[model samples]
Target: MTEDNIAKHGKKGTFQISCFYVGEALCGIDIGFVQEINKQVLLTSVPHSPDYVVGIMNLRGKIVTIIDLGKKLGIESTANITDDTRIIIVNSKQEFIGFLVNKVTDVVVADRENVSPAPSNIKGVKGKFFQGVYKYKNKLVAILDVEEVLENE
Candidate 1:
């Protein structure tokens, strides 16, 4: 373990990204930060908010804002929502936001070299929301920045 070896190898940047479905489209998030998966409940609609902000919901007496992942990510939302559809809650800089998802997919690990920067021109001006894009299986999934994606809302 010498400085030369460290310098030559570079630092590892691999992340264990968890794949989740928003309709047929595939998407991923770094699993290290996902807090828990809670199913839907009585969400109180917050009036005068952005379209992406669906509303607020109570979780064990604490209120949480639900962010529509499909709307926020510029993807066709998962329709015909069922009992399996869940709310994936994550924390970024101490703020908690819930993403309405169709279902939870298995988690997979990716290497540092496999991660690629998001393209400059993502359709619908949504390119900036992603932290990076990585491959899981043969399909490409965007890794979203939880904080940046929810900060404005």
Candidate 2:
């Protein structure tokens, strides 16, 4: 944990989080939920799936649903795959899924008490999709509610 984290979290229980970006917004997920992170993985589109479902990919014989994190959060699709674009593979409710993010930032320890309830609207993303929000480096990192995000529409 960095001194900044300690200063901001104020001695509360802290845990590490994997930070990433969705467009320009900073976001994070519990490191424990993340299985792996891949870059530019080949994806096959799924017909009749939700608009957020980018496609599916085979990961060592396991089929994982690929979700465009931006689209899932009501942001526009990532038009081009750049070097920074990545797929964060996470296990939610026993199902493996890949979330496409603009970039993977860093892992930082966050104080539990520092997490506050999500605002009704955050960078055009609905609050229900967020578990909470934390302040980091003068910016807010929205902590993704993985279970809520994986729930069927």
Candidate 3:
């Protein structure tokens, strides 16, 4: 833990988070869960797939399913693809998947103590998809539960 975070949150054992934007809401996930971040990638649509599933893409020799995280969380669909848009690949339960976001923001270390239970609804997303909420730089970053997010798929 850095002296700054230690003094700020007054806790030990700080962990890093990969921050991103989903609509106007700021979100994050444990950096350890992230496999890679792609600026943009070509997608092949899946027929009769879940609404959240954007499509599928080939990463090297592997096929990765892409998800529109905003829609999945009920925030908002990623309307336009811009330079800021990013696809964050994560490995969960030995499966690799990608989460499409409005943008890739920053990476920061946060104290576990700073994480509080998620509200009933945040930016239209159900609290069940989040592990907790952490305050970062006077802003709230909802920490996403990758397992929960990918479950029942």
Among these predictions, the greatest lDDT belongs to 3
lDDT of 2 at 62: 93
Candidate models: Cα lDDT each: 0.71, 0.84, 0.85
Q: What does candidate 1's lDDT look like per residue over 17-128, in tens digits?
A: 7778776656677776687788774578889988877778887676788877888777766434688787888877676778988888878887757667766544443667
* Residue pairs in clash, model 2: none
Q: Model 3 over residues 1-153: C-alpha lDDT tens digits? A: 235534543346678989999999999998989999987568999999999898999998889999999888887887468888889999987888999999998998987866787787888889889877889899999988888888877
What is the Å distance of residue 82 in model 3 from its true position?
1.1
TM-score of 3: 0.89
What lDDT, from 0 to 1, does candidate 1 have? Answer: 0.71
lDDT of 2: 0.84
Model 3 ranges off by over 4 Å: 1-12
Q: RMSD of each candidate? A: 5.2, 5.3, 5.1
Candidate 2: segments with Cα more than 4 A from true spot: 1-12
The lDDT-based order of candidates, best leading, equals 3, 2, 1
